[model samples]
Target: MIFNHFHDAYLYTLAEVYHKPQFYNQPRGNRSREVLNYTYGIESPIERICYVPERKTNIIFNFAEALWYLSGSNNLDFIHYYASNMSKYSADGRTLTGTAYGPKLFAYGDKRLNQWERIKEVLREDPDSKRAFLSIFDASEVLQLENIDVSCTIGLQFFIREGQLYMSSYMRANDAYRGMLSDVFSFTFLQELMATELGIEVGKYYHNVASVHIYETDYVQTKTVLSKAKQIGTVPAYPFPPMPLKDNRSDLQVVFEYEQQLRQGTITLKPVDIDRLDIDDYWKQVILLFAVYQSIQQKKVIDHTLYQKLIPLYQMLVQQKWESYFSIIMEEM
Candidate 1:
C-alpha cells in the first residue's frame, strides 16, 4: 500500500505486524521474536517524513547517521557520538564492519569503486539505464558471519523516468518499530539529494522489505505508538523547499568538517559559523540543530537566538502532534 508520509506507513505497519504471532530465532541466537514478511510504498517519501512522535526516534541521530553515510565515513568515534549503542555494533572496536553502508556504497573493497559516483555517471550518460544501482550488502563477509552486523539493506536502484528521479530500495530485513523510520529518513534523503544533483523533481520512493518484524522487547512501545496513532489525524505533507543551487557535496564537506571539530572540542558552534557555510538555509538549520543537540547532551546552555531561529522548523514537529518529542530539547533550552 502507498502512503503520503512515512509516519502513517510506519504506524500502519506496526498495527499490522504486531498481530502476527510467527516467532523466529534471531541470528545472534540470544532472542526469538515475532516476524512477518512485509512490503510498502511511500509516494512522497521526503514530505512529512520525520517520525518524532515515537519518542524513540532521535531526530539529531537520524540526521547525523545520514550525514555519516553520505560522507563515506566508518569512524566509530563519529557515529558513536550520535548513537552510543553503535559502539556495541562495532566489530573491531574502531570501525563498523559489514553494516558500514558508506564504505560499501562509496568505496567497496580494496579496488575502492565509488558506486554512488558511478551510479551518477551512469545516469548522466544514460538516463534510462537500468544498471544505475547502489549496492550495500557485502555477501562475502555476511555469508560467513553469524554474529556480526550484516547490512539490512541489500541495495537501491534508481530510475530517471518522465523527467523525475525515482528510487526503489530493497531490504532483506527491517525492524519495523526501531529501525524502519530511520532507514526511510536516510534513504529518502539520499534520493532527494540524487534528484537535486540530477536537476529533476523527486519522484516516488518504493520500499521493499523482505522481513518487517517487531521484537518482543519492543512490544510495549509499539503498542503505545499504535494507540497514539489512533488518536492522531493524518499529518499534512511538509512544504519542502526546492533544491538549492549550490553543490551539495561542497556543503556536505563543510558540515563534515564542523562535525569533526565539534567532536574534537576544537570548535564551538556559533551563529557566525552557520553564515560561513555556503550551504542552503535548510541545511544550515540542520547543522545548527546538530550543534544544539550536542550542547543539550553536554548540559551546556544553548544559544537562545539560534534556538529561536529553529522554532519554525520545530513547529513542523509540533504540527505532527510530536511537540512532546521537540519539548525534550526545549526543556533543556
Candidate 2:
C-alpha cells in the first residue's frame, strides 16, 4: 500500500496480516501471520513514528538505535544499554555479526569496503545513477549458524529523479510489529542524511519485504493497538523535527562520547549542560534523551528538569511511555 504517513501504513499492514494473512508461518518456532512480498511507499519519511500508546513505542530507543547505526559501531556494550535483550543476537557475545549494519556500511567484512562513501561518490558523479546501491546482506552469511541474527535487509538503492532524492530498501524478512518501525526510522534517517549531503529535497521512501509477518508473541498487543486505533479517539500525529540540514555525521563522535557517559551514569546532566553541548539543538535533544535515560538507569525516574527540555513532540512520546511517573512529576511541581 502507498501511504501518506508511517502511522497509517503501520496500522494497515498490522491489521491486514492479522485479519487476512497470505499464510501462517513459523520460520523459527515462533508462529506468525505472514504476507509474502509485502511492500509499501511512504510519502513523508519524517513521519516515521507510530504513536500508539498500546505499542509503547520507545522514541528514545529509535533515536539511540539510529545513532548506533550512524556511528558505524557494532559494540554490544553500546546497544545493550537501550535493549538489554539484544545481547542474545550477538554472535560472539561482544559484537553483532549480522544485526549490526555499521561495519558493513563503513568498512565491510574481510575486504573492508566503505559502501557509504562509494554510494556518495556514485550519486555525486552521476545523480541519475541506478548503480547508487548499498548491499547489507553478505553472501558469506549463508554459512552462519542457526538462531543467530542475520540481516533482514537485502540492500538499499538511491534514486535521484527531477532533483529529489528517493530511496528504496529491500528486506529478506521483517517483523511487522516492532522491527519494522525501528528499521523504517533508521533507513529513512539514512535517506534524509544522504539527501542533506547531496543538498536535494528528500522524496518518497519505498520499503519492500520478501516476508512481512507479525509473530504470535505480539498477537495480543497487536489487537489492543488496533482496537485503540479503531476506537473513537486515537493519538494524533505530531510534528517531528526534521534532521538538521548540516551534515552532522562528523559531530556524532561528541554525541557518542556523552551518550557513553550517560549510559555509564558517569555524569548527571541538567538541561543547561545539554544546552551547552558542542552540537546543534537537533543533536542536543538526542543527548537530552540520553540524559533522561541516565536518570532511569541511575534513579529509575524521569528527571523533571531534563524532561522539560524535550520538544513537545518528544514530550508526548516520552509521557506516553512513562505516564505514571510523568503524572506524579506534574503533580509534585
Candidate 3:
C-alpha cells in the first residue's frame, strides 16, 4: 500500500529481495532468493504499467496477455506468439492448463459456469458479499508433478465498498521481476474490468504472495534497474487511462478476432483505420497496440504520422524498447 503506482511497488519488492532475502529455493534448476508472505498495494490500479527504461518492460505482451485471459483462452500458440518463452510451460505442448487462468476464472467446474457473470450477480444481489471470489487453483489439477504450468494465482476476490470496486489477488508464489510485472498488469487490468462491469470506480489493488522472489538469473538486470531508480531519486508516474464505462464483455470476442488476425499476419490496420472502428476508444487503442506490435514483428516501417498515434506513454515505451527499428523510421523524417 506504500506505492501509488506499479513502478514503485515493483522497485520496492526488488530492493527488499535484493537487500534482505530471508530464504532461497530452486525450482526447475533456476535458483532464487525469496521473501515469504510478501504483500503490497497499488492505490491506482489502472496505473498498472511499469515504464522503467532499464528493464524495457513489454507493454504489448502485457496487454495481449490480459486480453487472452479475458477471452478465456488457454491456447499456447496464441500466447507464444507474443511471448515465445510461454511455450515452455505447456503441459501438453498445445495448451496451458494450470497457468492459464482464463478458463478457470470465466468458466470453471461441473456445469462450466460463467464465474464473472456470477460475481456480477453476486455483487448486484449483495454488494458486501465476500463470497465474490474467482478461483484459479484446483488441488486435483495442480497437485500432479507432470504438469509444468502451475498457476501463480490462487484466487481473486472483489469487494464493493463506498461505491468502489477493490480487488485482492492471492498467489502461492510470485517472481518479483518479470513475473510480478506481468502479474500486476494483468491482475489490475482484470480489477479495472470488474469495476467497469459493476459500474463502480476502480480502487486499490492488494497482492498477497506466499513466496515472492527474484530469480537468480535476473539478479544483474535487477541490480541495473535498481541503480537507475536510485539515480533518478523518484519513480515516475503516468496516468494510465481506465476502462470505458460500459459493459465491454460482448466486444471482447471482436477484439480477439482482430488480435488473431494481426497475430497471424493475415490482416493489418493503419492508425486511422483503428480510429474508424465502431468500438470505444479504449478498445480501439488496444487494437492499435496490436497493429504496432505487428509492425514490429513484420519489420514493417511505421512512419512518424502513424507512429505518433499511440498514447504518449505507449509511444515512449515502444520507441525505447525497439529503438533501432523506430530510429530508422524517425531518421527517414
Scored by lDDT, the top model is 2
TM-score of each: 0.89, 0.95, 0.95
Whole-model lDDT per candidate = 0.75, 0.86, 0.84
lDDT value, candidate 3, whole model: 0.84
Please give the RMSD to the true structure for each candidate, in Å: 3.1, 1.7, 1.7
List where candidate 3 sits over 4 angstroms from the true fold. 142-145, 233-237, 300-305
Question: How would you encode candidate 1's per-residue C-alpha lDDT over 1-333 as one tens digit per residue?
Answer: 898878778877777778654666665543435555567788886763544355445666777888889888888888898778888878789998766788988898889999988999999999999999898887776555554688889999999998988999999988887788788888988898898888888888988887777776888888888876666667743454444744577777777887777766677777786868777777787777777666655654445555666645453543343334445567865
Model 1, runs deviating above 4 Å: 21-27, 30-36, 48-52, 143-146, 237-246, 300-303, 315-333
lDDT of 3 by residue, 14-107 (tens): 9999889998878767899999999998888887866678888788898998988988888998889889888889867899987788898778
